[model samples]
Target: MSATTPLEPAASWYAASANAAPERPPLSGEVSCDVCVVGAGFTGISAALHLAEQGLKVMVLEAACVGYGASGRNGGQIVNSYSRDMDVIEARFGARTAQALGDMAFEGNRIIRDRIADYAIDCDLRDGNLFAACNARQLKGLKEHQALWERYGNTSLELLEGDAYQREVSAEGYTGALVDHSGGHLHPLNLVLGEAAAFESLGGVIFEHSPLVSLEHGSPVVLRTAAGAIRAERVVMAGNAYLHGVLPELEGKSMPCGTQIIATEPLADDVARGLLPNGMAVEDCNYLLDYYRLTRDNRLLFGGGVNYGGEDPADIEALIRPKLLKVFPQLASVRIDYAWSGTFLMTLNRLPQFGVLNDNVYYAQGYSGHGVTCSHLAGRLISEVMRGREGRFDAFANLPHLPFPGGRLLRVPLSAVGAWYYQTRDRLGL
Candidate 1:
């Protein structure tokens, strides 16, 4: 079965309480368009939105419902930057590439905000995202993180410690936090769903439940769905982890990793305020970190525990509840209202993989758990490339991606071992 073949998304809170949307019909016959985008998630939708705005006949083929993958199931924090920060990009790829990327480090955040306002997307948009320190080691790292981001010209960060930090997240054991006032959280499913509506408003087409079964790359690429085909002047592969092995070339370029999340029953007004006085979404500084935030309706949404190989854990709550309690033990009694897993593509270097395949087929994937905003930025960049521009896109396409150190079979185990090492360091405070 295709990875995107899940008849229904996992029983996520987002699915249970998703915004009202029409059940779009699946593609049933051959069609043609200026641009054919695979996957109706954030990137594909964003790309189609931009292209359609430019008056191109854009059609998005979705394997599942809109926001059915990581776009909807994530912790919903609009965290900025790639999984590997700008400093790492500069250190390894040099000041030039890093500078190019640094310019767009926060572009994704801006794109999301603009879409929310311009399209009047009612995704319950709010602001403020925090990075908490689990140890003194991580605390000091936050200081450097601030300096690095400041170098890139973002000044919306505020560092808090002791009483200040405790007031923000009324939790235990955190030393300090760096809050990006510009970063925020939202109802992810609603966000993407709204984007799809906006895309349709601009004359774009979306065929739900139409999975790309095969691709014929050429000047005018041909994509075959189970029941139909699309002959397009250009094609964009934005499926990411859920795309699975649709394209042979993308198979070895990254590994799909699953992460789980659970939502607690809504807390009383006072109880909710006490948990997060300011309603800021948060993530930790560990190698394998925990991320959480209070939902718009006052429920605590916490998530972590990366299970490599895109396999759902036997018990999602059992895997994530302990980690959630470690940060906010007071929630131990809070009933878990929902539990589910979504896979995100993880490349070896923790950078996104963006480049051309078979000449006319352009692709972008492996957000490495930072898809929320970066995917939007990728959409703009990739759309520009399709429109005969390549300057900004090259900053990402130029990055080299090596296959997982251990080929297909051992890649999962090797990645788990590497994650274990950093997790050990986080625990030992080394």
Candidate 2:
């Protein structure tokens, strides 16, 4: 693959209105730390923050500015679940283990709230998330899922039926939904930036524009870049989709997928409320899901549609605008002010990948589309494992993540072929 810099976020309304982040200089001189972290997104930054909080000397290197990846470009919906269903997880791992994983998924949400309160990070935090069912099939599954939530002792979830659902959401496409009061939305970029600053204030070192070009796993790992290098007792590879070829061993275990999002110009407060009367973040129940939420400023931040292929389409706004209009035709007249794409990693099983290379080098990624909360939990788990507390890490590492069947050259193509089939099935309502 040709070497690429961080692509500028498309004319996203978030970028135009996002709060400015503090500047940090790139690494110029070689540095040694207890741990060297690659990728400055939420995962890397959160790990650095946790490690620094423990008085561990940590350094973070980024390919671009902080929050430049999916950490900043995501839909900003702070959902409280994993990308894959519980049954899928239970089928692969036993019921006990699967239930444990489900609990951790919700733990990620609490981590976000605790961090925000601890650091006083102001990112327009909101409450409530709704998983809207578009048809009877979806509604049935959602109702069953809601009951399961109650059985699990999770009382925050409420099942909204037909009339209530229609009143809560302006769209007619959904029959009903499962509302989660604990789940919410936030300004992702601001949260990422604020977390990075907090980590630095605790004596953590972060190097911007310092992409790790190579890594050598050994007794003490070495991470090399264009200008400087890091030699540490332990190395954490947190660079998700953008982590191409940095480690050959990790190549086939995960594939980089692209997801896009668009933000519309701000609407009047009343209009925004009319669009989402409950002010809850909404996501449709489908393989290729459409998720949207109203920003505190009254703009609709719509994220739907994904690409299995690596390349970003030229007409991003054109590609996503129709989906937004489909959800709320009232917004058809509102102009889309911002749009952008970011790479997200997905494993074959849609479970997060966590493991060590020869007991010294550790890596975690492939959160699929549920990284907003999972990434933070990963940092805590990884940090704990680094401290020799491996129970939580083992829960995720125990699950199997096979490499893509076709290897490097044929992997993307083969996956794309299968994905195209699933997408077709989705379109035909199969």
- The candidate that wins on lDDT is 1
Best by TM-score: 1
lDDT of 2 by residue, 313-404 (tens): 78888988999999888877898877888778888888889888889878889998999999999999989998889988998988887888
Each prediction's whole-model lDDT (CA) = 0.89, 0.83
Give me the runs in candidate 1 sitting further than 4 Å from their true place.
1-4
lDDT of 1 at 105: 94
TM-score of model 2 relative to the true fold? Answer: 0.95
lDDT of 1 at 413: 92
Off by over 4 Å in 2: 1-3, 7-10, 420-430
